[model samples]
Target: MFSHRVAALRPSPIREILGLVDRPGMVSFAGGLPATDTLPHPRVDLDPTTLQYGPSEGDPALRAVVSENLRGLGIDAPPERVLILSGSQQGIDLVAKLFVDPGTPVAVENPTYLAALQTFRFHGAAFTDLDWTDTPAAPLTYVVPTFANPTGRCATTAERDALARACTDGGVTLFEDDPYRELAYGPCDRTPIAARMRGGSWIYQGSFSKTFAPGLRLGFLAASDDLFPRLVMLKQAVDLHSSSLSQKIVLDAITAGTWPGRLTDLAAFYRRRRDTFDAALHRHFDGHATWSPPDGGLFFWLRLDRPVDTRTLLPEAITRNVAFMPGEEFYAGEPRLGTLRLNFSHADADATERGLRTLADLLTEQ
Candidate 1:
């Protein structure tokens, strides 16, 4: 009834846990779904053109907006080279489509994005260190170096430089999914490693979901000359292009010059939630578990002092009216069962404190 891929496919733990997150009184730190207040309510001037079918490559004006954004991030992204996607997640599916063949060698981070692992595994991509430079190089590598999901860890300048150098030197194409770049709390450099690897085979992906609106479902990838046209063609086969109405609304927001400030406003608003989250971690899990207080982004990745399986803790967490993603779900290869990820932006101060307290107590008992 189903294909081999579908037969073996495992549901994403992050997505699976979301069902439990919404029950009354559940204090969830599971999903990366942004807080409601941070979203933009831009007005779209709905002409027939806005409702009508648009180019498979996306609305040219929106592409230009993405182009300018890439340039600002230190990548020389020409508007012509940009491929507009339904979301950055679609960009992942496209990259996998273009590169992965059954058992084809691909690399990814030790504990990378869960959805990426799911997409690649379905497409039959073999795992390498995937963390740039650590493993033997593969033809394609996917990474979220900027405030990565689940872990909320941003790669440092030296690490980025090394990854860039390694990819360029290794002749590997990088898929840098950087949706969280603009969500930094204070001044932090968020340069794409691909910026340094110009002319090298690479793909840089960005999303409007985090900064603008998720409903727009807008994301993009900057592919090299060889891969750009293929990705666009593939996207055409997938959905015939993203929503024209959504693209126009985002374009209107940029034209009205509210997009830049929206990014700033998001950082400022989420900073309070982040502060609450980091404080709770330090207070409750300092000795029981170790975690770096993220400077920005939605998640705080933690590794328990004991080798307790986080997967086993979810039922109890849900029973306790709190939820989180086990750290093991993020890994494509060997997993650190002691690890788990907590999201900060969606919940309030009291929820963060309560959730952390609940999780800490569970760990303390371990």
Candidate 2:
């Protein structure tokens, strides 16, 4: 027995496949898990407030630190507008609570984040493409403009400007998710859409999950005046507030002088992994699949030049002790077959190369 809302919920495809990943000697590139070796351990100096109940809007000092980081990236965020979340995942859930009514229209990018899709589906939102112009403006437009997951495609600055202008002109709210900016091989390729928006409603979400550690479970969104208060209200209903100890840890890392250097070191490390994977891809699957190399982020998205469905490829891959994400699960509507996502962040270079060669051999048989 369950509520009507429960009927709408579906498990995340990534998490669903992760159960198969924990098998002995399985080299999983399936989940969006960050490299464990790269995570930072900031000095922990806790205060009594960390043990006490804190504001649902988040700790003021941590919010200020998050606000300042956003400002440096060109978003016009102040500490006042920033509502700290348990993670950006919670941010998505709170957003679903605030704006998504049953049958409400929501526009999301094709092959978008599966967790976001699952959350909105739980709220009964009908999904559409980002260009939801056939009807009146969709209430929300969600995207990860910089180093997007699954695909790892960064939007061009021109494209970002056009999107900002269109959303501002159409009276729609833009939700720009930017978690992978700090992991860029070079300078971040695109300016934040929030910074470029011309007097329009928007939300800019950022997280410590990618660059730092997901266990911290700390992230935030900067919203406009109209949306921030209600988001805060929903957040209060959900968890009252995020972990005060997590807030202290991240705030310490950011405020301390070591964070920037750590980011630089991380970017270079991910870049090496990306290069290793890219080389193996070329050596093995080059003609069998087509893909654009991601400048940053965890995955390499591929459109296989064959007739096989990736959903059918999983069981065989499991037997081979290799794992990846089938791309169809990322779609809101019917999926485009023959596509998949491979993660380059978790395994070491030699393991990554061997895994890719095996994946390539699998693709070649079809």
Candidate 3:
């Protein structure tokens, strides 16, 4: 017999949509996958020792690299505070394991990242909307402040500060999941909320999945000294440590001095894709749907002009040889039927145009 947690687990709707997109001639705007062509594949030299098990906290060299990167983001984290995981998604799971219990109230943004909802739900976290004025007394709150997934909205500096203050005053721990911080298209001085908070009040999760290659599955969590040990222990229980070879490869890549230039190129490439997709959306469905043009990131969260259940519309979109994620999966509570998220990063400009046009035509028919 399976445990209740296992029983409650449902397959990710987005993952299911991704499978449908594999059909012949299907153009997808569904998955939040990074553009593979933009990823850097620098040569990494490894010794036999690099293949062995590594430190539970992470490889020291990799932690130092992550620490330096954090400093660039205006966060004052030292190598000692960093715990590397398979990916930032594991960071969410570790946090949930350590903190959340059945019926534990956890504050989450409305229509937040679906995987996060799934992670917290497995731990039996009772979700509530994050509100500064009436902040949830939950011990932890999870937020993707920079170019958040699905919506692609970045929280302003003042908003970050307000949330930090609320969390500090409420004794709530903040989990800042920042996978898209480096992907901004234009000038933005948005800093991590953890940078402004007291040392122990926040834990920050950063990933190479967006900026670099997702297949490497490299990510790190920076927490206060008090919280670091517990996380390492949980990580040890999970997999002993993340892949030793992958850590060395990431370290070598960053140390090689190619990372900075690669990041700039990645940002520029994604910006073009964003523009192309934005133009297509406007040309095809200007008045039929409304969406905030993302400043940076992979997605455009669109709200249909009329009430239409996206879940119901998905089959029709697939029938039209275009696929997109329905909005219901992104919500922790009752979902808004009119919203849907479209990702432009993985698809090329021409494919994006074709997909949007086909999608718009299908919606028009409905």
| TM-score per candidate, chains pooled | 0.95, 0.95, 0.96
For candidate 2, the lDDT comes to 0.85
RMSD of 1: 1.7
Model 3 alpha-carbon miss at residue 163, Å? 1.2
Q: Say which candidate scores most in TM-score.
A: 3
Candidate 1 error regions (>4 Å)? 131-136
Q: After superposition, how far is residue 321 of candidate 3 from its true place, in Å?
A: 2.6
Model 2 agreement with the true structure over 1-366: per-residue lDDT tens digits: 889998756666678778876677778889877888997757787778688999999999999988887888788789999999999999888888888999998888898898888998999999988753332258888888888877898887777877888888888888888888787875555688889876878888988998888988999999877788898999989999999999888888887788888888888889988888888889888788899888878889999987568989887987898999999888989999999999889888877877888888887775
**lDDT (tens digit, per residue) of candidate 3 on 53-169:** 778988998998889878777786898888899999899999999899999989998889999999999989999888755555678899887888778888877788888888877
lDDT of each: 0.84, 0.85, 0.86
Off by over 4 Å in 3: 20-22
Residue 190 lDDT (model 1)? 82
Model 3 TM-score (2 dp): 0.96
Clashes of 3: 0
Stretches off by above 4 angstroms in model 2 are 132-136, 186-188
